[model samples]
Structure formats: structure tokens, C-alpha cells
Target: MQQGAEYSLDDHGADGTRLVLSGHLTLASIGPFDRAVKAIDGPIHAIDLAGVEEIDTVGAWVVCRAAHRLSSEITGASPEALRLLASVQDIDVDGPMRPPRPPVWERVPLAVGDKVFGARSGIYGVVAFFGQILIGAGSLIRHPRRFPIKALVHQMELVGVTALPIIGLMSFLIGIVIAQQGSVQLEQFGAESLTVNLVGRITLRELGVLMTAIMVAGRSGSAFAAQLGTMRLTEEIDAMRTIGISPVEVLVIPRIVAATFMMVLLGFYASLMAIIGGAVVGDLTLGIPFWTFLARIQEVVPEHDLWVGLIKAPVFGLIVALAGCYHGLQVRGNSEEVGRRTTMAVVSAIFAVIVLDAFFAVFFTEIGWG
Candidate 1:
């Protein structure tokens, strides 16, 4: 009674079907094994592998897959065969499903912590940039010939000269609005003539420099970030360093100096334009002559107001340039990072300008500038 490479299904007297597996129960016997499994008319009741001469993982897989299809008692399998079968069974079994996700309320603290740490890192980066710039300035002072005169001139033209028309238009409209609104408010108190004082004081002391700084931050600051960020992505900055060039000196100092100087000129120009616009509005709406409006401004607005605004312009410019350059240097990876850094540069510059303006306001007030 020789057992070949096959499986036999036999029925006992009213007993359930028995699967008797035989010789070389490996890949070579796959066809017979599959056919024998399929030949069972009903579900398997018992498995007898005592007759199987040899077995492998493939044969074990066939047996495991067949066993899962029916609730049957397996018998006479050797320890090695059983171990292989168990592994195959484990491979075929699905993993337990994952538990439900946590609620968003549980994630709030994590989000807040992330933002706080990010902001702290940003502050540290800005401080480090300031220190680097100072060191670069010292080096340039020692070697005046290394100063980037051409880059400074180019940045001045880009940041100041090219920005004139828009700055003029915006300042002019703001002055007109201030005059018109002041005239309306003061009319009830028979102080309509004071509209000149209102426009002159606000424009010279705050709005002129403040508005120009914001515009420059949005325009040139973002441009600096995007430009440097692109250079960084292309490894141009690395190339510069490889050739013994200092990026802080070549890329940063020129921009900061240019913006600071240009801002002074632009702020002065913006203030003058705004005052002229106020004069125009007074002449048309309040029936006051342009000469009278100008005279009233000169008489009522303290020279200290003009001095205060002029003093703030350079500081605001420095902040804008530093913020832009710092974020630009921080750029990593790809074009998307360039866009993100540009946005961050503009926002950080504008916010710093506003905060500095507030500090100046307090200091001036405390010092009896009014």
C-alpha cells in the first residue's frame, strides 16, 4: 500500500469526511492537493497528515488555507510540520483593527506648545542675525575697500526710487481723508480751522513714516526674502562661501544700509506730499486758501513732531531689512519654502515696525515731546 503524492478523502460509516495527505506534500504535489481539497463535497471534519512523507512552506500554506475554510480537527502532524503550518496560519490572519482616534480637544495643548516653541526659535534667530551683522560691519570698517557700494546703490534704487509713485499716492489720499474727517469733527466746536493742525501733526509725527515703512516691508522686504531664498535653494550662497565670500557682508549689509538711507528720504518725501494734499483738500472743501492752510500748519504743528517721524524712518528700515534677510537665510529645501519665508519676512517686518512705533510714541510722550 504505497502512498503517492496526493490527498485522499474517505468516508467512514456515517462518520465525517477525513483528509489523508500523502507523499511529497510540496509544490510538486500542488495540483493534486488542490484537486483533492476541491473534491470534498462538504466541509472537512478531520485532517490526517500521518501519511505525508515530506512537506514545505508551500504545502503548509495549502493546508492552512484549506483548514481555515472549515472547522476541522487536525491530527498526526509532526512538530516541524505544525510549526510551519502555524506560521502560514499567522501570515494569513488579519491584524486587529485600530482603536478610534482621540478628540481634537486633547490635541489643543500640543498645537499651542508647537507654536510657542516656533515663535521662541524665531526670536533667537533674529537676535543671532543682529549679532552676525554687527560682526560683519566691524570687518567692513577695518577693510573699507570690501564694502559693496554697487549693491547698496542697486538696493537703494529698487527700494526707494522705484517705490515713489505708490508711496506718494497713498500718502496723498491719507492726508486728504485726515483733513476731511478733521474738518467735519471740529466743525461742531467752531474749530474747523484746526483741520490743518490735525493733518500736519498726525502725518508728520506718525502716519508718514509708519505707512511708508509698511509699504516698503510688503514690497522690498518680501522681494529680498524671495530673492535670497531662491539663491539659497540653488546653492548660490554656498558657492559664494566656497570662494571666500561672506554672505553677511555681500548680501546683508548693503541691503540694510540702503533701506535705512532710502527710508529717510522716502519718509521725508511722503510727509511733504501728504501735507500738500491736505492743503489741497482744505482749499477745496473748507474754502480755506492753500496759503492759509500751509501757514496754519507751520504755526500749529511743533517741529518736534517732524523730527520724531524722521528719526523713526531709519530704525524702521533697519528692522525691515534685517527681518527680510534673516528669513531669507533661513530658507531650506524648495520653492515652497521661498514663498513661505517671503510671507514671514513681510509679516515680521511690519509687526516690528508697528511695535517700534509704539515704543517711540511712549518714549516721546514721556520725554515731553508734545
Candidate 2:
């Protein structure tokens, strides 16, 4: 009538110990049983699975290991006892070990709330992040000339040069839309001539550079995090450290430089393309012509606007690289960690870019640059 079963630990021979387990050897049983077996000494260990009514692979591994271990020390028990321990399958076992069990959620943190990020935690995490960067920095300092010029060139070209077409295309389309929208409203008021004003202000004040930076952040930031996270998970970071290479100078610095340069270039391309798009729409809707639209844009948007866009580009670049690398360092395990980091990289990069843009917007506006 009783549902619960008991397991016993006994000493059989003078130099041997025995564990008589009774109950379902489920996940719960594995821990205590494993611990008990571990506490034994001197190589004389015998485990009696006869009392274990039910057994799982994990439980079987414990018994089999103990039997194998005792066989090695106590002589003749090796082959036979080891075989029997190995053979303690559900069908062959004499008694079933039955233990009450619950789900593992109690022992594990299931959600974001489980992720602690308090003052100490933040300080520790920041410390760890900087520590990794320091290792990277140290590697750079030690090697001095081991720079992977080829890799750096490739990353810059891919993240920067190749991004030009898309950035230009997207910015152009956006400008066209803006120009069309403004032309529609302005024409009703016989203010169609102001299409250039609309386009120039929008591009210089916000759209052109911000949009380009956002695109680059989403593209390059995710790439960096995914790449580094994969490397971190695979112990490549460890290997680099063991080899005495600084990850900061070798990995982070190059990425930062490449992205910074790339973003600046992309920002320029996006601005130029947007201006062209605006001119196209202006010529058609306002009957103003491309050259006129361009001249008007030049007249209205000062050299300072271009400088604003250019300056914002590198800051956004820094945000993207820092976010990506930070998230990459957050990675702990396998492919899942890489994906999590990549998502974090993108989300954080965009958020940071927007924050930096807001700061720039206010600062420039205050200084009469807007």
C-alpha cells in the first residue's frame, strides 16, 4: 500500500561498500545517489541496483560507474558486476525505485526577471565587459604588428562599401516621398517653390544621416555581435588569450575603426542620393528643375548641416560597435547565445543611435545649427 521506497547503503566485504537503491531512479534520485557514490573512498565500491525497482539512463550510469570502479579495485567483481550494473534496464531490474519529482522550473530562472541586473550585478557585468576588452587591448599591445590587415580591409569594405547601394537607394526613395508629400501640400498654397526648403531641412536636420546610421547599426551591429558571440561561445576568445593576444586592439579596435569609417561614408552617400531624389521629385512636381532644386538646397542647408551629419556618423558608429561588442561579450553558451546577442546588438544599437541623435538634435538646435 505504501508508495514510497527506501534505498540502503551497506558494507558487504571488509574492503567493499554497497548501495542498495530502491525507488524510481528519476532526476531527483540521480543527485543524491551520485553524491553518495562520490563520498566513497579507496576504490572498493559496489552498488546494488537489485533494490532499484525502476531505472533510467542517468541512474544506470551511476550504478554502472560504481560497479566498474569497484571491479577495478576489488578484483573479480569487474566483468560480472559491471555487466549486471550496465544491464539494470527497466525490464531486468528486480524492484522499481520510485521518487516523487517536480518540474525543474523551481531550480531555474525562467524569464527576464530571473536575469539580475542590480547595482552590484551591473558593476560586476561592466567589470567583466571591460576585462574582456582589456584582454583584447592587451593582445593588441603585445603583438603590435600582428594586425590582420586583410580581415580589417574585408570587414570595412563589406560593412561600408557594399552598404552604399542600399543606403543610397533607401535614402533616395525616402527623399522622393518627402518631396512628393511637400509638393502636394505646398502646391495648394502656391508654395510649390518651397519643395527644396522642405527636402533640405528634413534631410539636413534629421532624415539623411540618422536613417543611414540606423541602417548601418542594424546591419553592422548585428553582424559584429553574431560573429564575436559565435567566437566567444566556441572558446576562441580563450584561445586568443592563451596565445597572449589582446582582443581589444585586435578585435574591437579594428571593428570600431571600420564601422566608424563605413558609417561616415554611408552617411555621405545617403545624403547625396537623398538630395538627388528630392531634386527629381522637385523637377516633376514643382517644375523647378534638378539644378534649381539643388541650388536651393545648397542655399538653404549650410555647410554646417553637412558637418552635423558627418559628425553624427562617427558617434553612431561608436554606439554600434560598443553595443555589438558588449552584447557579444554577454554571450555564454552555444548558438542560442549568438542569436540572443545578435538581437541585443541590433536593438541596443538602434536605441543608442536614436539617443545620440536626440542629443545631437538638441545640441545643434541650441547652437543655431538647425
Candidate 3:
């Protein structure tokens, strides 16, 4: 059976009123006890708890709150009850409800600095990863047995052959759009035939290699990061290291080699698809016919344009692979980190590719290959 609880107010001779508490002063008894306490008017001089049969933290808090409000003392509390009351006494029920936040303007400089630091750290990691991949490549050259040929073939199939459909479709569509737009502009000045020159040169010199790099970065680079990040999380990388195996040789080098070789092949394929698309668009819309379009492309789009685009493929591949593996190796703990690093890998690879392409454009132009 639960015990009953009560609080009684009695006027004292000199020291004001005494609050007499009795029975169970606990969670079960708090409702009636609290109501009885609240009914009393004026300040309480003292709290008499000797008649309290049982007490808990909740009961102690009630008594302490009443005493604090009335500015009175507590009498006849046992050691445990007294300790509970003492602990809750200093608690600031009237304290600030929420912490103050800094103004937006105050946070701008700090945010900028943090981003700068993160970019610097990422650059350093990528450079170190590139150097490590180089070392692994050299080791494979010296010790052919240590080369991961199967892994290389598998990655090539995944990163190159598997990605062909999407790369081809995207390039083809881009070519159609470029040709259509170029014809619209060129027709105004009676230069509709120049659409062939526009499509061929743009596709060969820039779009073919650049677009393929971006797509591969989004596809293969993210997969590389996710694969290695998962391995790191599961401690598989650690096991490899323990068994005297280098992760760079087994995991990193194969991916680097696959990406580097495949980019050239995929870029060439994209250029072909883009040219075909442009020819189809010209035949249908401009009535230029496929043979005429191809002949014009061959005549106008120089050999240097194709060479310039193809040469950038391997470098772009290396950037994507390095970014992906670098972030993957940086993964530390959980599935969340894996996802975060994968996204970082794709973003970093794409950014690096665009910046490098811009530099290559300036470089090729400076050498009179523009």
C-alpha cells in the first residue's frame, strides 16, 4: 500500500510559521503534498520534516524550493534528504533560458579561415598520395610479381568498359545541342557550314576529354573512395598492412593505372560519338548531309586539336584517382565518414580537372596550338 502524505502550516510564537510535513515525501505522494504546501499563505519560518516517514530526491527538491521561496530553514531532515536538498538549493531556476549566439558578421572571417585551412590540408594529402602512388608504380616495375594485374584489369573493366554507355550517350547529346546552337548563330551570317568546324574543334580540343574526366570522376572516383573507405572502416586495410602488404600497391596503384589508361580510350570514344551526333544533327536540320559534315570536320579540325585533348586525358585521370584514393585513405571510423569522403573525392577530382583544363588551354594557346 502507498503511504499518504501531508503538509500543515502552524503559526509559531515568534519565528513565523512552521511547515509540518509527514508520511511519504516521494514521487507517489508529491501531488497531494504539493497542493497542501501551496495552500499555505505567507512566508514559512521553518520546515519540520521529522514526521516524514520516507523521502526521495523529488520530495527533497519540493521542500528545498519552498524553503528557498519563503527564506526559511529546514529542520529534522535525515542526512540523505539533507544532502539532496543542499544539492538542489544552488540550482538557478531563474537562469538564462538560452545561450547567446554570435552575430553573423562576427562569424565570416572565422568561416573563411576554416575553409582555407581545409583546402590546404586537402592539397597536401593529394600531393602525398600522388608521391606514394609513384613509389608503388616504381616498385611494380622492379618487382613484376608484386603488380596487381587482376585488380588492374577489373578496374579497367569497371571504370572504362562499364562507363561507356553513359559517356557515349552524354557526349552524343552534347554534340547535338552544340551543333544545333552553333548552326542557329552561324545561319544568321550565312556561315551555317561553320557549325562543322565549331563542333569538331570544341569536341576534340576540350569537351571530349574534359567531359569524360568529369563523368569518370563522378562515377569511378566516388566508387574508389567508397570501396577503400569501407575497407578502412572494416579494418581490412589494417589486416593487409599487418600481413606485410602495401595498400598503395594492392589498392591504389591498380586504380591509378586503370584510370590513366582508360581516360585516353574513353576520351577518344567520346570524341567519335560527339562527331557522329553533330553529323546526324547537321544532316537532319541543316541538310548538310553526313558525308559533307565528316569531310568538313576532317579538313577544319586540325590534328593538333585531337592530340591536345588526348594528352590531357592521362593527367586528368591521375588527378581523379589521386583525389579519390587520398580521401579514401583519410577515412577513419564509420559509414558516415565513408559517404563524406566519397563526396569529397568526386568534388575534388572534378574541380582539379577543370582547373587543369584551363591551364592546359592557356598552355596550348601560348605554344601556337590554339
Candidate 4:
């Protein structure tokens, strides 16, 4: 049987007030005593626990809190009670629950610094990833038997063959738009005949490969990221490593090889389709025969224009594939990360392709390939 806790207050005039506690000072008996102590007001000089039969952590916490609130000393406690009080006091944290927000000016600089640091780290990570890719390529070259031929073939079909219809349709529509617009503008100058020159030069030298790259980035690059990200989330990537497999070789290298090999064909095919589309539009609206427009393209378009597109194709493909695989490998945490990385892969690949195209344009113009 346990006695309920009880407390009484005494005042000693100039010496301040004292709280005297008695009975079992424990969880089972402390409730009313706690409420009673809280109701008492005025300065308290000491809490006398001499009559307390036994005390537990809850009772010690209640006593310590009252002592702290009143700025009073604790006296006449047994060694066990004192020890419990000390432990509770030690664990009690005193501070605001939340931090203050920084000023806008401080926040702005911190945000900028974080972005700069993140960009630097991202660049370093890309360089390191590129190095790993090179190493993997070298190892594969030395051991041809370890090459992932089936995966490369499958990726080639996915990245190239299945994409042909959409690429062709897009190119055809673009060609019709360019030819119609160019003819309208050229008509003002009485050079409607020059629509062939405009369409051929622009399509072969720039739009054909550039448009194809963007399409591939959106299609195949996103697919790569999503596939690899899912694999990562499911721990399939870990399982592969556990079983002595190289994910880079089995997964990434095949995608890179497929995209690189297929881009040349896809770019050329897209350019031809665009030219055919222009010829069709010319026949219908510009009074030029279909065959005549086609023949005129060969005569007006320079050989270097075709070479420029072909040269850019493989490089663009490599960039797209690398972006996809890198982002995919970076995926962590959850399914949401898979979608995020996939989006990043497409955006990064497209951005890189456009930037590189600008650089290539400058280089070609400087070297007389323009």
C-alpha cells in the first residue's frame, strides 16, 4: 500500500516561504500534490523533502520543476531522491523550440552560395563518372567476350527503329512549315524559287540533326533514366553487383553504343524525310514539280552541310545517353526520385545539345565549313 503525496507551505516573514512535502512522492501519489504546489505563489526559499518516504523519476521531475520556477533550494532529500532529482535536472533542456529566421539579405547570399557549391560538386561528379565510363570501355575492349551484344541490339531497336515514325512525321511537318514560310518571305523579293535553297541548307546543316537529338533526348534518354532509377529503387542494381556484374557495362555502355550507332542513320533519315516534305509542299503551292524540287536540293545544298549534320549526330547521341545514365544512377530514396531524375535527364540532354550546337556552329563557320 502507498501513501498519497501531500505538501504544506510555511512563511517565515523576512526569510521567504518554504514548501514542506511528505508521503510517497511517486507517480501513483503525486497528482494532487503537484496541483497544490503549482497553486502556491510568492517567493520560495527552500523545498524540504525530509518527510518524503520514497521518490521516483516523475516525482523528482515535479519537485525539480517547482524548485526551478520558484528559485528555491532543495533540502532534506534522501540520497536516492537527490540522485533522481539530479538526473531529471540534467536531462531537462532549456531553450526556444524553433530557431529564428535569417533576414532576406542573408538568405539570398546563402542560397547563391549553396547553388554555386552544388554546381561545382555536380561538375566534379560528372568528370568522375566520365572517367569511370572510359575505364569500363577499356575493360570491355580488352575482353570482347564480356560485351553486352544483346542489350546493345535491343537498345538500338528501342532508341532508333521504334522512334522512326514520330521522327519522320515531325521532320515532315517542320519541312512543310519552313518551305511555306520561306516561300512567303522570298516571294516579296521575287525569289520564290529560292525556297529549295533555304529548306535544303537549313534542314541538312542544322535542323535535321538538332531536332532528331531533341527527340531522342526526350524519348530514349527519359526511358534510360526511368529504367535505371526503378532498378536502383528496387535494389536490382545492388543485386547485380553482389552477383559480380558491372552495371555500367551491362546497362550504360549498351545504351551509349546503341544511341551513338543509330543517330547517324536517324539523322540522315530525318533529313531525307524533311526534304521530301518540302518537295511535296513546293509541288502543291509553289508551282515547282516534286521531282524538280528534289533535284534542286541536291544541286543547291553543299556537300559540307550533310557532313556537318552527320558529324554532330553521334556526339549528340553520346551526350543524351550519358545524361540519362548519369541521372539514373544518381536516383535514390523513392519512386518520386525516379520521375525527378528522368525529367532531369531529358532537360539536361536537350540543354547540352543546344549549347553544343551553338559551339559547333561557331567552329564550323570559323573553319570555312559554314
- Winning model by TM-score: 3
| Rank ordering of all candidates by TM-score, starting from the highest | 3, 4, 1, 2
Count of backbone collisions within predicted model 2: 15
What lDDT score is found at residue 175 in candidate 2? 93
Candidate 3: lDDT of 71? 78
lDDT of 1 by residue, 21-99 (tens): 8787787667666777755667778778898888889888778767766666677899989998887877643344676
**Relative to the true structure, how large is the alpha-carbon lDDT of every model?**
0.89, 0.75, 0.91, 0.94
Each candidate's root-mean-square deviation in Å? Answer: 10.3, 12.4, 5.6, 8.1
lDDT by residue for model 2 (110-229), tens? 444456535568568768877876676666678768767777798899788888888889999999998999888988998888888888877865788899878887888888898888
TM-score each candidate.
Answer: 0.73, 0.66, 0.78, 0.74
Query: Cα deviation in Å at residue 40, candidate 1?
Result: 29
User: Clash pairs of candidate 3?
Assistant: none
**Poorly placed runs, candidate 2 (over 4 Å):** 1-124, 127-148
- Which has the higher lDDT value, candidate number 1 or candidate number 2? 1
Q: Cα lDDT for residue 341, model 1? A: 95
Under the 3 Å rule for N, CA and C atoms, how many clashes does model 3 have? Answer: 0
- Ten residues in a row with the worst lDDT in model 4? 89-98
* Candidate 3 regions with alpha-carbon error over 4 angstroms: 1-89, 97-109, 112-120
